[model samples]
Target chain A: MAAAFTAIGGKWKLTLLYWLAHGESHFAGLRRRGAPITPKVLAEQLRELEADGLVERVVTGPVPARVIYRLTPYGATVLPVVEGVRVWGEAHLQRTDGQSVSDTAMSCASSIV
Target chain B: MAAAFTAIGGKWKLTLLYWLAHGESHFAGLRRRGAPITPKVLAEQLRELEADGLVERVVTGPVPARVIYRLTPYGATVLPVVEGVRVWGEAHLQRTDGQSVSDTAMSCASSIV
Candidate 1:
């Protein structure tokens, strides 16, 4: 549980996981998908997730050095928990317009009370 | 959901909440239940939890200065999620002997992979 929490609890980690779960994604794809995220932060978080073993990094080719981030078995185990959190988040995470989940990360739990 | 996650995702927050779920408790009660927890760390965590609004602080007497921590309504909302995490943790958190959960906090999600 702690691994799962730590894996998904970083600044851009949850958003990164959310994107990767859909399918394999390159770092650029994620950068395009999420605004307010710089390429450096994206790469840094991907490395952290990969090193933590939550994300699998695969090199696709030698010519272009294409890399893809995929969810590993460990990452799969926490997807359900993440889904639960997402469902719960959508319900209460909209208090301040349609802000991103990370922006309101601390609000969802506090609002229920 | 983010609120729920953050609320329960602290270092000793989940364990503290689990004990509190059973009933209101003084600081000493929690320290006794969980071994290797210093009185100072316990007090610090309790104060943090209280500040987060997950635990309610009450002063009971004028003479002896009794204080008990209770779960707030916000805290109650996240208990289900915590229970889910605990159940998940118990299933996967026992690879390294019967050491305390604090020692194995990062192992639970990692093992699932």
Candidate 2:
């Protein structure tokens, strides 16, 4: 359980992975997707995920290069878990009063299952 | 996503719920199950879970009353999510070098589904 939590335990790790499930995103794109996450924390979480082999960071172009983040093939293995969390979150939000995943991520997560 | 994480997020909420899935336990018992959790944090987490309606605290006896913590019927709703985390953790542990859930919780969690 700790391992699972460690891999995706933080507030933003799963959310980041959820966003990546749609396709790769540049650092700014991901930052925009989860607007509340600070750049420092986002970079840290992305680094941790990359270390865990669930996310990969790629550099595109030369100077003023764009950094892309995407799920690795090994990372794909965690999609089911991500979907479970997303679906549960959506349902819980409906039951209680809370913010929810965006429609795009919601539909994409549902379809992935 | 925020709602779901709020309900069972944190390092210990899901684990607390996972232990309770076996049966109700008192403060000491819960402490024993999760040895590393500080008393203050355990109380706080239990209080939060109770406040969220996922866990219930029953007082048995008077004078040095026994406090038993158990999952509310609604709390059972989060079991699938907990199970997903546990199963994923187990698999991730096998693949990586990480701690695994105790045999008791592992077998019980497996039997739950």
Worst ten in a row by lDDT for model 2 chain B: B104-113
Error of 2 at A35 (Å): 4.8
For residues B11-90, what per-residue lDDT tens digits would candidate 2 score against the true structure?
A: 57767777888799889887665346799988998998898788999988775647799999988988888788778766
Model 2 - which docking category? acceptable
Q: Which sections of candidate 1 miss by over 4 Å?
A: A1-54, A57-69, A89-113, B1-5, B33-48, B62-65, B94-113
TM-score of chain B of 1: 0.73
Q: Which residue pairs in candidate 2 collide?
A: none
DockQ of candidate 1, scored on C-alphas against the true complex (2 decimals): 0.19
Write candidate 1's Cα lDDT for A10-59 as tens digits: 55565566566778887777766635667887788788778766799998
Worst 10 residues of 1 chain B by lDDT: B104-113
